[model samples]
Target: MMPLDNRRLLRSIVKLTEKPDVRAFELALLATLTEIVSAKTIRLCKIHESAKPPSQKVVVDVRVSDEEPLGDDASLPTLLIDDAAFLECLAKEEKVVASIGLGPGVRIVHPVKAESKMVGFLVIECEADIPRDQELVSIMLGFYKNYVSLLTHTQRDKLTGLLNGTTFDDKLLKIITAQRVGKMRASDGKGLYYLAMLDIDHFKAVNDKFGHLYGDEVLLLFGRVMVDTFRDSDLLFRVGGEEFVVVLRDVDLAQAVAILDRFRLAIERYPFPQIGKLTTSIGATIISGEDLPASIIDRADKALYYGKNNGRNQLWIYENLIAEGKLKVAKDDSSVELF
Candidate 1:
């Protein structure tokens, strides 16, 4: 049978990590290599420099059935090489590194590097009897280097280069779940969290008058604003269309309002190309423990509607409805307009 081709596989690896999920990208890389070399097992590891014992090494083990040829069971070399020796060789500042036949199988190691520094490593291996193909190794190593380069491009926003909308949502949900379960480190203080929804005032009008291209420019500008206004710890998602949501963990009603107010005024004061008198409306609410993600969003949307109605370019805290005597608990969806 013809052996795997390195040049073509390197190109494929370049395309793979361009995907949103890096883990998925790595898995695909191993799977492709497995086909070429007829190997058995692939284990990718991210060894952190500062981690303690078990916590330091984050390992992703991908196993293909032995019935399958060239799965994770191939005879690849393992890196029983000392940590210091491995780190020292990697200090040569190479992106792709490999070792063969130390453990039960032959193995390949690729460093995940961003901005010229090694962040982690990817390792793939196979059982003892499997012959390690030199051509395949060359191909896999080069492919891995290209994959790391693609990861840098794929994980960021096309414009602002913050995490893209979909990525942000995935990361946000993970953070929320982690914090809720105490898997994450707690912040200095605590209370009901808050979600603020912000919409650019007269956004459609700008698009209509200035053209869709400029409207995109406006959205990108607004994203920059959000990045500047919120803390690094805060989570923001461009939910859809012209709407963005900010989740502030451990924030109470009053703090939520103040933060939203600043965002509102920032939009109002900022100037843009071809668009004058820019402004935004904000709706915010303290998220309760009983609330689901949708419920929290709905409450914020209701408050946003109130802001738009009262006058655009303002902030409204949902909890203020009861205090102002303008709202009552409703049996149906009467309290807030969904759209």
Candidate 2:
């Protein structure tokens, strides 16, 4: 049988794999690490490398003080930028250990790779030199990296790299719960969730004419456009060929319309490798807390189909269509007629 210390250590490492979400994993990582290393502060920093000077969002941070933790930090400035070490770490493809300015605390930043890409950094702050526990930190992070790759493999679409259909239901449930809580938004008098369902206009024709090679390429490029267009907070998913879903987080009707239409326009103007250009039709609706996933999907589908039926490349919001008397939905619940 394994010894008591060995068992406890193994259990801590195994705890890392239990979390299915990348976000929750951040907090879990720090919590588990703190058990072993007596650090002053450790941060799981996610770098938005796409932005100028690169914005940093500390997903999880621990500090030995009675001060506020870094929430949404401001974008790094040109003159006071801290991108050098992160960039250097990413460039050199290795850990960059440094000493805190005029302090005994040692800072260690390691590259976090997931699905064969450098996603972010794991920063450790400790009293003693970090090299002493470098090997242990490396091993723990190796487990983290592998689990992330596996998680993404299960969640992402094979062709597009957008989220696969299997994970949408779980995400939808969480969205409903978050909306129901309505903590920050409740007081602010703003922020609502919108779900958009879209389809590639005449995607069958593209596949029919160009064959699956370019069809696959188009799907791949479509995913790239979504990544470029949507904020990191927004959820993007490919629910099978030509059919996609987007959950626009915390936006008003106007913002939802603007962004959805912008995405449609972007898709319409995107130049395909051999196909020249392509367009998409979108259907969307405001998500209500009481609405079930099936009901929300139904509303979005009605809005989406109306667009395809009318033209082929447009955005339609379900509530707007109903308000305009252009469409009607059944009151299956038999409470009060919503239409």
Candidate 3:
């Protein structure tokens, strides 16, 4: 964060207010931070940790630079994360403005948190360290933090913190438009995206046997597994009950199948408290730009039900099953409006 001018600040607040969802909100925040800084470049770096973040490298989620933008892999943190900077930032209480001396000038480190847990750092470097920069950073980020909490609360399910069903249609529509699914396999971008429906096998039994507390724990742990297993770009939602959705960004059919099955295996291996072990059945299909949200969900749901009908804990793909004659291409305007 940097010194926020009144007019620039007003515009930043307005821009942030206009974003429809978190992804757009993030990019907008990046743009705002960049605009106010008056620097040659600025980036909104996000740390996506694995099971553990301590040893892992940070992911620069978005950037604005003087040169060509950071390509996906090219955006890996050149920030002095290995030394004290990143760890110190993460450790500090939120709103406690701190700076690590690195890269051309003093870089201000502001910890961004969600639900009291540190999510990432907001790093901005300005050549001239103004007297009130830290106070401004604290004020700017404090507003950001509080609004982020409110927006997150609205967007995510109270139980799982996965995007709620209300967000599904908007999210699905965004991806469908971005990929332009049916008309063309978009260039440079993976032409098609995979949408998968996941259900916990006999989840009702878990609740019945262990009670809702344990069942809720299982769902939470399951949500964590989904987070750890998928890329940040992928969209995840808890549509209803034990059912969930994962939109695999820009991956092909084979990769989608492998990834979904890998998650199934991960669930199977997990020891769920008194429940001991649990598994998930997954069904998925390639998204088509021409398809309605209902139609796309219907395809994935069909595959999911097919897997449930065949076996309790397995993964199935719509096209693969259709090719094998285990499933049929949907006809007769058969579509499920899940959300």
lDDT (0-100) at residue 323 of candidate 1?
65
lDDT of 1 at 115: 49
TM-score of every candidate: 0.54, 0.84, 0.82
RMSD of each: 11.1, 5.2, 5.0
Predictions ranked by lDDT, top down? 2, 3, 1
Mark the regions of model 2 whose C-alpha exceeds 4 Å error after superposition: 1-5, 47-82, 98-104, 183-189, 331-339
Q: Per-residue lDDT of 210-278 in model 1, one digit per residue for the tens?
A: 998999899888888887777533556676668877877555566766777887777888888788679
Clashes in each model (backbone N, CA, C under 3 Å)? 28, 0, 1
Q: Model 2, range 135-159, lDDT digits (tens) per residue?
A: 7678778887888787778878888
Per-residue lDDT for 1-339 in model 3, tens only? 555568878877887978766557777777766655554444456666457556464445454221121245656454335746667666655433334445555666677766667667776666655556556655666767777777888799899888899888777886666545234554544535788999999999999988999999999999999988876556789999999999886577677878888899999999888889888999998887777788888888888988788877988888777788776544665643221
Order of models, best TM-score first: 2, 3, 1
The numbered model that scores best in TM-score is: 2
Better model by TM-score: candidate 1 vs candidate 2: 2
Pick by lDDT: which candidate is best?
A: 2
lDDT of 1: 0.61
